[model samples]
Target: AGVDDGSRLRLRGEGEAGPPGSQPGDLYIFIRVAPDEIFQRQEYDVYCRLNLSFSQAALGADIEVPLLNNESKIIKVKAATQSGEMMRITGAGIPHVRGNGRGDQIIQMMVETPKKLNKKQKAIFQELAEIEGNPIKETLKGFFQKLKR
Candidate 1:
């Protein structure tokens, strides 16, 4: 039931029949697979992107990812996981159409920063920024000054 796109199949005697005593023609079928919403197929491999919150990326957590077979699996995200980091689920991808084994699922992590923070959250971030010395702001300021000069 999981035939890949652009696959071809032939059924003998399934097409239009010849004259009364002649044999029927062979029917050829070309397969075309529809695009999935969550997963993308590359050969036998599957890939998808999972979004993580800032805290989740900074701190480790167990996350659920959907499978191609309508099931979900838990993945352990390591602490300080950065954006664009990839995690692999072995044997969780598309199966080889003509072989016996399956491919792997490659998940790319995307860390999403908070767009709006409450007062308490802002205060905490402010404290953290001060503790970290807010180097990013200074770096950008210095770059802009250099450009102006």
Candidate 2:
């Protein structure tokens, strides 16, 4: 018997009829692919966020990032690049249909800053300020001078 789109039934002696009495019908099976959380399926590409530390963003480091398959991959990025810069990971996207070719992985860079600073860390920052010539006071003085002008 022919496969029905919704109906479920068996027609005897109607499909591949054999020996004038015995016959076999066609059996259909449906399969579905699960959606991945880490990979977003776009028109022809995938995009995801890759978080980096402040130091990592400043000093450029090779970070170990996670792929959609729950595997770790190393990707190198420029340390001085701006946030939201895209890094393409070749051949790391969803499988293509009709041989159109697989998609690419787009990684959006995100910089994470430190939340808290300890006393020693603050002292170090103050020392850096002194070394940098403490431009804050000079900047304010310049502003007042411009107003007077």
Candidate 3:
């Protein structure tokens, strides 16, 4: 009786007629889009998670992002990209069943933390950490110092 997310469509005289000369009934159609593993739909928008390596995130990269139509798009990752930040790709999402407009794709970034690093990798990371100087504390040190006053 009611429509779902998309625009409602009413087809006049598309249904069976009541009598030989009586007015025909109207056909109401609704579209239901199924859930996808790679993308989650919210209304018409699509959202997906994307993981990036430490180097890829810090150095920036352009990777192929998959879309709903069996297509992939090149998404640009800015340098120093952080986890939990969202990027948007316009018009790359599911199209409205009744309208000509298409939704946008939202990409949630996840910067993978290094785990079980090899001997060489551990050494390099340790050296880099030392050079970076307590990334979190260094950033908050000045702010925390203000709290003392």
Off by over 4 Å in 3: 1-34, 135-149
Regarding lDDT, does 1 or 2 come out ahead? 1
Which of the numbered candidates is closest to the native, going by highest lDDT?
A: 1
| lDDT by residue (tens digit), candidate 1, 13-105 | 999999999999999999998998898888888999999998899888999999889999999999999999999999998877775889999
Better of 2 and 3 by lDDT: 3
Q: lDDT scores for all predictions?
A: 0.89, 0.71, 0.83
Instruction: Write down the worst ten-residue block by lDDT for model 2.
Output: 1-10
Query: Taking the tens digit of each residue's C-alpha lDDT, what string does model 3 give over 59-122?
Result: 9999888988888989899999999999999888767878688889999999998778898987
Alpha carbon lDDT at 91, candidate 1: 92
Clashing pairs in 2: none
| Residue 79 Cα positional deviation in candidate 2, in Å, after optimal superposition | 2.3
Q: Would you estimate the TM-scores of all the predictions?
A: 0.80, 0.59, 0.67
Best by TM-score: 1
